[model samples]
Target: MYTPKDFVESRLPVLHDAIRANAFGTLVTAGEGGIEATHVPFVLARDEGPMGTLYAHVARGNDHVARHAGEVLSMFTGPHAYISPNGYPGKATHHREVPTWNYIAVHAYGTAETFTDPDRLLDLLSRLTEQSEHDTGQAQPWKLSDAPADYVAPMLRGIVGIRIPIARIEGKWKLGQNRPAADREGSARLLEQCPGDNEQAIAEAMRSV
Candidate 1:
């Protein structure tokens, strides 16, 4: 991530927030042939290290996991939108600005390792399900144990568990931090007025940031 000083998110808390908001991350690893990537929902454990621990899994038969054990990069992408020059007040001055993308993304580079332990896999699945529905106060929360043992056992065999010990974390908040104040304000207004949920959220981000 070639981030300029103006767009770097050095604050650990801010970086964590971005990762949490976008838990589904891209897992990248280098292999004997080349690089491979898989999209997976990750659990980030903050207490585990200075950065954190990342948990995710893939299908057991996944051939991509076999060739790599080196460093892995997990990318978390947040609200992203395009800022149009039309939003700028400087349009009246004919400043002629190019459109740019505003977004928040967190990249975690870590050591990749696999977990084949049945107990660990069960625990990880339970944790993942809970995290998925943590906001809902479901008295009978869904669990891996809910399924029949026979079914659960077979299902577990189909997946491979992984833990990535985070070595470095980088965050990028390209929310017009490098742009002029007037242009940024105009972009916010323009994006907010546009259609769709993603763009609206992006607009709100520009204003708040």
Candidate 2:
């Protein structure tokens, strides 16, 4: 990310929250065949490493995982919305404002490894399912053991589990931190009125700043 000084966010807790809320990330790696990317949901093991560890899986047929090695990146994107120039209160005076966008994101880098053991894969699936179900407020959430072992065993065989021990992390919160108070407030009001959930989220973020 080409983050400006005003938009840089290095706080660990905030970065972790961003990753937790946006568990799905774009996983990218470079190999002999050039670059490959996959969109997948991740499970964060915050205590596993200095920066934290990431867990996810890809289809058995996905050649990207087989070719992946060395450093890889996972990008988590949070709330984002367009800021129209007309929303700026100063636009009437200066008439020089331009449209911009506001958003939050995090990038994690680490060396990735694959897991092929059936037992490990089963554990990974169980944890992932549990996390997702719990986040969605399912009082009686589904579990891996809910299905017959014979069915799950065969299904698990068709995927590959992956682990990334994160070495570095970066976060960016471009929520008009550089803008004047009046402009920020005006844009936030417009964002709050927008129908999209992300736009409303940006409005909330603006208010906090």
Candidate 1 runs further than 4 Å off: 135-141
Q: Write the per-residue lDDT of candidate 1 for residues 50-105, one digit (tens) a residue.
A: 88899998998885766786788899999888778788898778777777888889
C-alpha local distance difference test of each model: 0.84, 0.90
The alpha-carbon deviation from the true structure for residue 121 of candidate 1, after best TM-score superposition, in angstroms, is 0.6
Question: Can you write out model 2's per-residue Cα lDDT over 1-209, one digit (the tens) per residue?
Answer: 78899888998778988998999899999988899999999998888878788999999998687786789999999999999998898788999889998999999998889987899899899989998998989779999999999998988889999999988899999988998988889999988788999999999998887
- Per TM-score, the best of the predicted structures is 2
Per-candidate alpha-carbon RMSD to the true structure: 1.8, 1.1
The best candidate by lDDT is 2
